[model samples]
Target: RKQLVYSSCRAESAGKALADVMPDETVHNILLTASLCMGFSAFSYEFMPTGDARRFNYIAMAMTGFCTIGYVSMYNGVGVIEVRGHDVFWMRYLDWAVSTETFLLGLAMLSGADRWDTIFILAMDAIGVLCALVGALIPAVVAPAYLLGAVVFAAYNYRLFGTMQVSADRMGAAVSAKYKRLTTQSMAAWCVYPVVYLFCEMTRALDETTEVALYACCDVIAKCVCCFLLLSQP
Candidate 1:
């Protein structure tokens, strides 16, 4: 039934321009450029000298690497599904699932979090992303799923600022400061996603162009800018 609906929608839009059926050409171009930039940046991490902090480079690579693939898929007009009248970019959710886990892993490593703490936090993040993905796909479940994702996000932040912050402090003043900065910046960038989803996917308050631009900007900040900051830290 779902496939039938998607096919019918595509068939109906066949008479329309390509942008009307899929993503706008400019947005697709931007996605392609962003993917290439992230791919190159991830590759450049290979030359960094190995050490205790070098592991963070690996985490950054994974985050950007996944995003690179996701954006490239989007550029190629793949991984997008039509639900109702809206185009849902499912690949972004997949990218977030992996990238956010590696992101939290880097933070956990910096804070010296125990294995259990790390596992628990990663689980919460995964559940939150899953909830968001479900909400995007199913119109009826949007409210409940959004609320659930928001709650899970809150819980993740609690653990991050509570236990993770404490552990970072124990590491030393420098580690603690760096951890706080990265966490705060990343969290702020993450908060934009739910807002974008609410407006673009659920409420339809924003148009597709705005949605793509906002998401693209947020991805750059969260993955590229934050990863650069993390790698540049002494």
Candidate 2:
């Protein structure tokens, strides 16, 4: 009876936590489910940071940090309530490592190590964790599509980085133009991904019945835009 009661209480608490974060009662399920999907989508790209040019490198790092923090907060509050003592220690370490890695990656970039560094690995790990949590929580409705996008995005970043690295050898205005275009396009491309994420959350909060559809549409649109932005550079 005591165990049953404890489980019931935990369930109640979890529901409350979910309610608190959700923007509206009507679309609570959608928001919760969407966040879970997004989280899982994010986890898959956590480890492909290799070969990113400076701009892409920085964006990858930022994405990882955002996804990690978002997942930790969402998971701890809404998904896992009865975490065991041993797991608690690991969770603490996970949190610390993610936070520390994010911080270090930022500091390294700002201090000018963006060209080459191992911070990429740390950022990727954080992203992986975020994706895993999403996989664990969200309904698998649109997960496969999201995962495809992530894989494509990672590959795009890799190829872009390779092109930039080779372009460094060019002389005169070509070099400058390549760098300028890359910087501008990458900045523009990355900004859209986060905006799409925020839009999905906001749409859920607004209690829209089309929240999932809208998010999927927006995500596809955003990916297209990012691709265009990247292409515009070369």
Task: Estimate every model's Cα lDDT from 0 to 1.
Answer: 0.87, 0.41
Give me the runs in candidate 1 sitting further than 4 Å from their true place. Answer: 1-22, 48-51
Tens-place lDDT per residue, model 1, 96-175, is 99999999999999899888889889999999999989998998999999999999999989999999899999999999
Top candidate (lDDT): 1
Task: Please provide TM-scores, in order, for all candidate models, with all chains considered together.
Answer: 0.88, 0.29
Candidate 2: deviation at residue 121, Å? 16
Q: For candidate 2, write residues 1-234 as lDDT tens digits.
A: 999999999999989876654333433454355445444444543443434444544444444445345444534443222221101112322543454354334333422333444345345535543543343234352255346435544643453345443444344474545554544454344445434433343122322345434533443333323323332343
Q: How accurate is candidate 2 locally (lDDT)?
A: 0.41
In angstroms, the error of model 1 at 55 is 1.0
